[model samples]
Target chain A: MNEHTPTPTEALPGAGNGLPSYLEQSPAVRERFAQLQQRKVILEVRDLQKRYKSLQGETEALRNINFQVHRREFVCVIGPSGCGKSTLIRILAGLEKHTAGDVLLDGQPVTGPGRDRGMVFQGYSLFPWLTVKRNVMFGPLMNGHSRDSAEREARLWLDMVNLGKFADAYPHQLSGGMRQRVAIARALVNEPRILLMDEPFGALDAQTRAKMQRHLLKIWRNLDITVLFITHDLDEAIYLADRILVLKANPGEVQEVIEVPVPRPRSPEQFSTPEFRATKARLEALIHPPEAQGEEEAEGEDALPEKIIRFTNVGDNVE
Target chain B: MNIRILLTYLSRPSRYRGAVFTLGAFLLPVLLWCAVSYVPFIWHPMVKVENPGGVDYFTPGMLVDRSEFQDQMKEMRQAGKPLPVGVRANPIYLPAPHEVARALYTAFTTAPEQRDAPWLHQSLWHSIQVIFWGFVLSSVVGVPLGVLCGTYVTLSRLSEPFVEFFRYLPAPAFGALAVAVLGIYDGPKIAIIFIGTFFQQVLVIANTTRKLDTTILEAARTLGTRGWRLITHVVVPGILPDLYRDQRILLGWAWTYLIVAELIGTSSGITWFITQQARYQHFENVYAAIIIIGVIGFGSDLLFERIGRRLFPWDRTQERKSA
Candidate 1:
């Protein structure tokens, strides 16, 4: 085995440091990788916990959670539906409170709703009374931007989503997908560095969800910002994430971190490859861990040698 | 003529929607009234006579030929008056329908006494004033309180039972309460109209607040829209369609209460005038007041509907579905 320094890019694999396994080309590139790895400490969650007690009995939503998100990384918190995924997102979004533990963002704990992180819910919560331009301009206007500049920013964002033509239209006039586009543009126009999306594509139809997924990837990759997305979809976890964090049911904890090894500008075709399958299989193993049967894991790890052989033979730049 | 208007109406597309109800209910009675009064096509015997003690019957007011009476002769001597020359049957009500209609029109258009005296100098003007006062007070008081009570759970919970209790109370009973509190003056009467509609307006506003789509509130919160600004930009707009609907309905209730308010005393208002004239046995004035109430209520409703549709085209689909 050999050692290698991490790269500045998160999704892309490291590809340098051939000199004595410790020396890189320049001090600057090494520093860049270190800064990318360095904790800008955008958000730090420490021993977070929430429990719900009812006549039916006490049910824990989260228990002793810990994580740190650095600047400009797409951190996806994926889990099953009732696995406290929504509860965790709601706490982060400042809609709900945890029974215990601290959530620190930007060196300060989140006390209430603020514009530091713009959120988009699964429901396209566009104000029906407002046009797209106004809806997008809402945050900027509230943050004390002049109406003219706010509208200009709104137009720019709408154009980014290819929805400039519908800026004058009301939300009800738009389809679900189009409305979601407006919501994205609205959230983006505020210029928040951290975008919190709580299953924002959940309400969309499957076809529209795929389209939105691609659009989100393009937009997200282009913007130098971090996204904390919560979703129950496993395929989505594989598709749009740099590194995926899975949460199990009852009390959500960071169970696994699965890095998607696909190249940038990820296409739907790349997902059918053996590398993608291998990564997905590892995630499935973590999620549904073979029901206490240790033999399956022993055989599964042995069978993976053929999978690598199959990958190089069948899936090398085939497209 | 009405005939031409009716013909033009029937020829248009989608005429049946109008024809199936409104025109039939409104104009059919007029048609029947006119047919019986003026359409000279049918004749029927008014009285029959049999031999004495052989089931002989005499209807006292059913004499068909009373042409040779003295008043008829006296009317013949009057310069421009015509004498009765042929058999004439008096209607069952004594006065024919056309005569009553002519009298109704003359009273409304010329003297305007029957319409004017009860309400104001004119029925339309007075109704407008009453409705305007009632509407203004209701909005000024009802809207802000409703917004406050709607948004705050504590305030709404504390006040809801009392508000609900008052909302369902009869408007006329409130009129009695007003009379007792403020005396029999016009102040009490108008106050009654205000009280009658206030509870309903508040209930509507409160309900609109409660029914606000939860998603918008969450979105607004995320957008840094909190406090008064949230109520202004998001909550208020979210509830505007329902508020606008309640505005129209509230005004209608105000109009209803005003008529009852007027009947409190034999001094003023269209109701008072109608009651006084009916005391004098002037049925024509009573009819005129009925017609005026219909005209005023319908006219205000028309204005409300038009303004409602024009300002809020988004609600047009809602209205159409409800219709």
Candidate 2:
């Protein structure tokens, strides 16, 4: 296979290189990388395990998951469906309990959901009854901030998401993309230490999704908060993350954490870069191994057996 | 009205068209009633006696079957006496629209023949109060219990089965018991209304509460909301519009039990007025009172729906459907 298609287990052709080529290409990128490495870890997940017990039996959803998100870093977790990406993010958010693990935020043990961790779900979760501004104010007000101060903070966050004009608009009035922006504002108004997003852009159309990715990256660039985004879209994970935490399915576990070689201050034009293609190829190999691909192809041929009964005279459309 | 617009299936008409249809809905029935009442050949099976000449049993203003009146006239003519005079009329029970319309006004103005009997408005007011207190009390308990039940599985398991079972037992069955325990007064009447609506309110509200998106609650939790704050800030507001609609429907259900409830104790309320007027064979007044009950029920529902739109301007589901 070409250097772009290195197997999951094999090191890249330039593995021995002291520094990734993209870092060497720009002094600003090198400096940013150094600063990122020096930043203290804001979120740490150690030996996280989750088991769901039902009448049928116990099913391990996630096991031995371990990762650390440095302050202000953008980390994306990508995996196939049912790979426990959502479970992982939920555990981090304290929305779901893990059977065994220590999720530490700034070295404080995370228990249940708290303002320290904010979450945005894929589904439009805005309170249908509240205006965009009120939805954003919910957190601060709930946490004992007076209505005036909460409103001020909510407006600031709404403006940050470029939805200042829509503060009075209801969720139903806004498009799907706009609703998610409001949701992000709602989450950010509390100024959480870490933002956990579970496929927050999964529901958007391709154009909207790309636009939101840019919007989110801009916000992340300007804010001091760290992000832990979960997505199955490989391109989305590569486009936004400082580092990509890959997971394999079944009893989901960490596959490999790839340091995105694409330089910081990223842009859409860099999508076709050799570094970007290299990282994407590595992810593809890890997620869809040759063995599985061959098996799927074999199954595709015989998965549909010859029908025993024909209800229509319509011949097979495919030649 | 455009027939093409009216006949379109599963499509909402324009606002003007909808208003016209609504008016027609009301006008059509009243028009049909007028046609039956005024058209002599349509269904006037009886005749009102104008004069009782040579007929010992016939009296002026009395209604006799058309065939019987004819036979009497034939007999009277054969005897060579002045024939009875009559005009086609409907059965007395089926009062004309004009009479009922007159009763709508006069029923309030007409004083009770017996001293100390409550006026029509007073009876209506009492019925309204019974409905109000009954529904209010049911909602006061039902809304919270239902919200809690929907939020917590333990509470749901503890209460839902019993609520489901109790709702199946007809509320009227508790009427005699309520009267026995509370008293033969407004207490039992109110209790009957309470029993009629409370169980259903709890279940319906619980279902509505369940329909609230769980993701919103989860989002609230991550925002540091917990304990009673979750219920007050998240659960309640999240389900308020749906709860408002459920309460409206439950209020209607409470109205359905009003007559049965009033009959349980000492006869009172509009139900009492209706029975009293019926006993005097003032069928027009009875019809007027019944229409008033319907008008009150339907009018209150419209008022509630309007208030709901104001209270939840953010809820566009209703607006979308109507539009």
Across residues B207-233, which tens digit of lDDT does each residue of candidate 1 receive? 889888888888878777778888888
Considering the true interface contacts (CA pairs under 8 Å between chains A and B), give the fraction that model 2 also has: 0.95
Instruction: For model 1 chain B, give the 10-residue run with minimal summed lDDT.
Output: B47-56
The CA lDDT at B138 in model 1 is 74
Q: What DockQ values do the models have?
A: 0.26, 0.50
Best by DockQ: 2
TM-score of each: 0.76, 0.89
Worst 10 residues of 2 chain A by lDDT: A16-25
All predictions: root-mean-square deviation over Cα?
11.9, 5.4
Q: Pick the candidate with the highest lDDT.
A: 2
Candidate 1, DockQ score (0 to 1): 0.26
Candidate 1: give the TM-score of chain A.
0.78
Best by TM-score: 2
lDDT (10s digit) by residue, model 2, range B27-136: 99999999999999999999999999999988899999999998998898899988899899999899999999999999999998789999999999999999999989
Clashing pairs in 1: B118-B269, B118-B270, B119-B269, B119-B270
